[model samples]
Target: MALDKRFIGREYGPFTYTIGAEKLREFALAVGGARPGAGTPGEPPAHVSPLLYDARAAKAGPYFDLIAFPSFAVVFAVRPFSAAIADPELAVNMLMLVHGEQELEFLDVMRPGDVMTTTGRIENIFDKARMSFLVVSSESRNQTGKTVVKGTWTAVIRGG
Candidate 1:
């Protein structure tokens, strides 16, 4: 069955997340190809920037604090997309769905202790060839209500 076009524009949450320094370091190290172990995020790779893991170095650098890696926004930013996919109303077939594409725009730096709130809505639902496509647009804001990230998420479901 095809996805109902009437579901387009359905809204998802104002999900909230609080950025933590340790998680930031862990994410950077993991993405930078470090091996993690008990109680440590692991030794950061040489190519990784100290501004992402070292508080002291970050404190002296431009942002004056440990800053999250640019892509870390996806952690909190993906909430709404997740919600939409899991929503029973959509009746989406999980096994047939794959993440199609993603685009994120970072408008500001993220730091530890910053709280973020995200909201999104289904932007489009369409069928092409033999597949169905779902697109959702999201925005995340800092505690002060500044837009920190904007995202466009796409999911494609193959015809069974």
Candidate 2:
């Protein structure tokens, strides 16, 4: 069955997530980057390994404190759209779906202990040849009500 085009412009979720220091460090480790959220052992001056080892580097950084890796926004923001695409009423064929593309804009650095609210909307729906495309845009805001990240996720759903 083809996806319902009328579903375009549909909105989903103002989901909330709180960033935790442990999760941030774990994500950094999983992605194999310098431990931006891991604190140096012992005291500051002599014990510090460098900027890479500073857990509070984001705070000490030119950007913000406990800065999150940009990709981390997807952790909180993508869920709403995931729910939307999986909605049975959308009548999407799960096996036919392929991740098309993803674009994310970092408006502000995410910090540990910050609470984020993510909202998702179906931005566009179109078809080309035998494939249908669904484009979803999700924006995440910090507790301060500032947008921190905006992400666009595109999916290609193949038709029989």
Candidate 3:
């Protein structure tokens, strides 16, 4: 089935989520360090860096708690669109859909304890070679109402 062009500008969700320090710390350590408990890059010590997992040291800096990794927006942004794609009126080809690409623009620092509100919209949709390409844009804002991240998700549905 071809995607309904009428739904191109459809919007979805203002889903809210709270960033957790422990989860942020865990994500940081997983990405930044050489290895857990190994300390291979032993010079600076992992604790000094917010991405290295030292709860106390992370707070010593300007940010009172662990700062989220730049790409952490994925955790807060994707869920809001579940309803949009699942809409019966849209009739998306779920089994034939494949993620195409993603683009994220970080507007501001996202820190732990910040309440994030994310909303998504169907920005564009097109068809070519029996495939449908859909672009969904999701924006996330902090409690203070500042946009922290903007994510553009692209999905290609085969045989559309």
Alpha-carbon lDDT, every model: 0.95, 0.76, 0.78
lDDT of 3 by residue, 58-88 (tens): 6786766667878777887986456667789
lDDT per residue, candidate 1, 15-102, as tens digits? 9999999999999999999999999989989999999999999999999999999999999999988998898989889999999999
lDDT of 2 by residue, 128-154 (tens): 888989899998999999998899999
Report clashes for each candidate as comma-separated counts: 0, 3, 0
Runs in model 3 with CA error above 4 Å?
Answer: 29-52, 62-64
Residue 82 deviation, candidate 3, in Å?
2.8
- How good is model 3 by TM-score? 0.81
Q: Please estimate how well model 2 matches the true structure, expressed as its whole-model Cα lDDT.
A: 0.76
State residue 148's C-alpha deviation in candidate 1, in Å.
0.6
Candidate 1 vs candidate 3: the TM-score winner is 1
Residue pairs with backbone atoms closer than 3 Å in model 1 (clashes): none
Which ranking of candidates, highest TM-score first? 1, 2, 3
lDDT-best of 2 and 3: 3
How far residue 117's Cα lies from its native spot in candidate 1, in Å, is 0.5
